[model samples]
Target chain A: MFPEELKYSKEHEWVKLEGNVATIGISSYAQEELGDVVFVELPKAGQEYKANDEIGVVESVKTVSTLYCPVSGKVTAINDELSTQSALINQDPYGKGWIAKVEMSNPAEVESLLSAKDYQSQLAG
Target chain B: MLKKTALYKNHIDLKAKMVPFAGWEMPVFYPAGIIAEHKAVRSSCGVFDVGHMGLINIKPQTSNIKKAEEFLNKIGTNDVSKLIDFSCQYSVLCNEQGGVVDDVLIYKLIDHYIVVVNASNTDKVLAWLSSHAQDIEIEHLLDMSILAVQGPRSLDVIEELFGEEFGFNVLKRNNFLQVGNILVSRTGYTGEDGFELFIPLEEIEIIWDKVVEMKVQPCGLGARDTLRMEAAYPLYGHEYDEKTTPLDAGYSWAVKFGKGEFIGSKALSKEKEAGPKKRLVGVVLSEKNVPREGFKLFNGGAEPIGEITSGTFSPTLEKPIGLAYINNSCHEKNISVEVRGRRVAGEIVTLPFYKHS
Candidate 1:
């Protein structure tokens, strides 16, 4: 399941854009598949990244998954609370688990991301 | 194709995450997750389908118990003659060079003895036993299934289920009792007090359901690994490989050097005097990094001293813990491990990060 207002990436990241700043977090589907989230490595504020850049990491008991930058931007903030309570991603993936906020460098890259419907279709196929 | 245990369909019905482990399609965990299942074993009780474990029976061909005891002593690292009837002891099977073949539990039954071995090493162990067969009759009990009921409350739960006829209260650690056809032993891999039931294949489901009805957590291999590691119990493949000896894996107590002419006794006796080259040690990461197998260990330096054999985020400790084979010379109170190219500080705690009275 995915939210209609958000955009999705093939890597299971969800982006909610508000003007030039877009908040990014892993979708609920991704968190569910990872079992229990134990730790997360977040990109720092002011770090520059290109679209599809390897930016962060999420760890569960049995696996480690990389978090990819959905679109080109400079990171502005990260959810600091995740360092202590990493299970927030499993508990509330759309809200308090938001990984980072980025100031989009190229607005045109937004067109490449799939809508919620397209993402759901991609998962099905 | 992977091997399926007797409880494979039951695991599938529970929607367990089935993974290929030791050539068997076994459940890694259920929906409750590994941490919760691990906690259940620590605080209350949990059940595990250990049907994949190998069971072998050894009895003297001429009905001589002394000959059977002698045969077992020649094949096992521990002195099997020490076992009283209906008692069990942890032992290891070793190669000619004193390297570990597998760690096993030997149960002395009334008329014969049973050796429980790792699932992955069962075939090899059987072949080894056959090669060393003298006057003993070897019976392979692979068709049977084993269920492990573990944790602090396990005895009470088992007593409640089996009722007074089973006499769960009278059973001591490493002792066993036969109720109906099932042989229930007060033995477990997890550090908790528990029982491992040796049952017929047809009876596995009924017993599993009965235990589940008692509200004990149904754990899988994922929690099983974490629980054993937290207790500093060495896994066969991880801590005791074909290249490692029991003395090297922090199990010197399991090896009786003076047990008299065993397969690896001569070589082990020699090594026992000199000590092993590498020693297994427990490492608790100072950072949040989960130490993994094959990761290099350092003592606050760039050069590597050892490698991790088994590691995980301990559910009981709430931190990353690991077992490693560091150079015996470099072992100290404080050390560091290279995790993802960064040297995370770690402390050398004693084996078994947790224990309960």
Candidate 2:
């Protein structure tokens, strides 16, 4: 059940808006598809990216995936705790497992992403 | 099209993540995952439903032990001619150019020897043996369903189920235990102290149900891979194949030359006399990324030399490791592996990376 408070990317990443900076984390459906997240390679702070750009990589025991950004922004912060504690993503993806924090270039871009209800229907389909 | 084993329903019920391996539907991981499964097998006991592999029961005619022996004498240099009834020997069947046909465990069962081959190469092995042993009878070549109960504590659990029915104590390494229709062997690929119980096809489900209640955990092919890698055991397709020669792969120890004329014996002897050029070694990663198959291996100077035969996140080690064939006289122990185009350092160590106590 995706929370209605969060925003979703077509790539299945979710963003929780908190002022000019938004917290980014892969959605539950993305984690389910990716299986266990063993190692999380976070993007560097201050790194800029375009919408849907591959900024980071996450690896499970048997699989590896690139993290796609939902919006164009400067990477202000990353979850350093994931370097040693990767299971955080599997346990509380939206909370402690939040991958990175990006300073938004335009808040209007949020409207372009899918809402929680829409993402659920997308998954169901 | 892929093939499914009899225990397919059982795997799904256990919430296993199914994957295709060598054209057979197999469970790569289950509810416990590979890490937990590997630890279970190391500390206690694990049950693996390997019913997909092929088992051929061959009844050889009298006065033809030599003929039967000559057929497999091609792979190993150590003499395998003295094998008697109810004994088993691990040997590789190779081609004339020293390429491997299949690495098999031959169990001599009284009048016949049961050949257990890799599931993918069952038909291929049969075709090769049929063309070569045309003079002999190929009767009762059955694909009997089998399961392996392997671990240090496996004996304790199995003794409770089957009892001392076959006088199993007398069975040494490479020996088979036969009591009535049941055939059990003191052999396993997991490098743990265990046994491979060859149950009749119709009776597999019943025996499986009985044992699941015990201490044995249903270890799928996932744990099997990690456990084998921890023990530094090689997979047939990854380590040795039709194009790979015996000498270069460092499995030439399994090829016998002193035995009289046999297929691929001459080439193996030549390779032996010339000395092996390449050897297989264990490479453990210093970092997080798991070393995978086909990753380029480089020497200390960061020069490309060899490639990893197989690699995975070692459940027991809690890190990444792999097996690769490198030049024997390479001079340096440190080598670099190109994992996803990034240079990750690795150290080459001896074989059997992990040994269970």
Candidate 3:
């Protein structure tokens, strides 16, 4: 299930924009496909990444997946709890499972992301 | 085209995640997820639909146990003479060049021997055995389906299913008992005490349903892999292939050179004397990084020394553990695995990252 207030990327990342800060995490579909989340490699704070950059890594018991930055910006904060409790991604993908918070370099990039309805359609297709 | 096992519909009904495994469309996990399924097998009871594995029946023309033992000894690496009636022995089939064909379990029935091969290498093992046949009938038991009941409470589940009169309590490890058409062997891939039931294809669904009714968690290939890895068991194509020998895989105990000459005996014997060029070792990463198959291993050197064969996050240990074929020359304490172009520090620990108490 996807949230209506969030913007999604083709790589299955969901972005929540509040002013210039965008909270990013993987969608519920991605977490379900990954099964049990065992390890999450979060990017360091104060690191700059462009939109669509490979920012971090998320590893399930079966395989590893790359976390892509939705909007280009400098990472302001990361969820340190994910270092020990990666399964939060599976438990609550949209809430407590948020991976990183980034200060957006260009707020216009949010328009390029898929809307909740469009993302649902993309998943269906 | 992918093949479907007899329990394919059952897997679908359980809302399992189906994946292609060794030419068969098998369930990788159920809705309970891999970690839950894995933990169930370790702590409680778990049933697995292992019907995809191949079963080959070898019967001597003379029906003599001695002749049958002789025939099996020529095909496998273990000492077939030591196998008693209704007992099973883990053995490896090898090519003449000392390379492994497939690891198998030889179940010696009263007058015949049943060889269980991996699903992927079934055709090849059948062909290999047929070509090497001498005054023996090799029949592939296609109608037979295997179901494994594993974990600490496995015996209780078996007793409840077949009733107390079956004498499941007396069934020793690596031993089997036939009840009607089904053959229940006290052997399993999981490290826990368990049984593998070789049942008729038509009766598998009923037995599976009965096991499920008893609240036994149904496991899939994903949990099976993790369980075996935690037990440090070698899987075909991951630990050993046509290029590797049993000694190379740290299974020299399975290869009995004193049992007389068998396939690859000469080469394996020489390798044992000369010492193996490579040794399979268990690795535990210090960090949370999951080392995957084919990931290169380094010993604080610029060049890669070996590569990972099987790796996963140990649900029991809650750490990343793997089996790697490292060069014997690189005997360094600081072993690191190259994961995504970054070196994660690890140590070569003993085999079996987790052991059931």
Sliding window of 10 residues with minimal summed lDDT for model 2 chain A: A29-38
lDDT of 2 by residue, B61-142 (tens): 6557665555555433345566777788777788887778887877775556677889889888887877777445554345
Q: Pick the candidate with the highest DockQ.
A: 3
Candidate 1 on B1-357: residue-level lDDT in tens?
A: 999988999889888889998889999989899899999999999999998899999888997888889888888899998999989999988988999988899999878999999999999999999889898889899668899999999988888878867678789999999888889899998999999999999989988988988999999999999999999898988898888988898788888877678988888888888888899899998888788898898876668889999988888989988999998777578888887777888888888788966
- In the order shown, the candidates' DockQ scores are 0.58, 0.41, 0.82
List per-model TM-scores for chain B. 0.97, 0.93, 0.98
B1-357, model 3: which lDDT tens digit per residue? Answer: 999999999999999999999899999989898999999999999999998899999998986777778988998999988988899999999998789999999999888999999999999999999999888889999999899999999999999988889899999999999999999999999888999999999999999999999999999998999999999999999999999999999898899888789999989988988999999999999899999999999988798999999999999998988999999887886799999999999999988888878
Q: List the residue pairs that clash in candidate 2.
A: B75-B255, B76-B254, B76-B255, B76-B256, B77-B255, B77-B256, B88-B174
User: What TM-score is obtained by chain A of candidate 1?
Assistant: 0.98
TM-score of each: 0.94, 0.90, 0.96
> Mind sharing the TM-score for model 1?
0.94
Can you list the residue pairs that collide in candidate 3? none
Clashes of each: 0, 7, 0
Give residue A82's error in model 3 in angstroms: 0.9
State how far residue B322 of model 1 sits from its true place (Å).
1.2
Residue B98, candidate 2: Cα error in Å is 0.6
Model 3, total clashes? 0
A38-76 per-residue lDDT for model 2 (tens digits):
778788999999888888888766667789888889999
- Fnat per model, in the order shown: 0.32, 0.16, 0.79
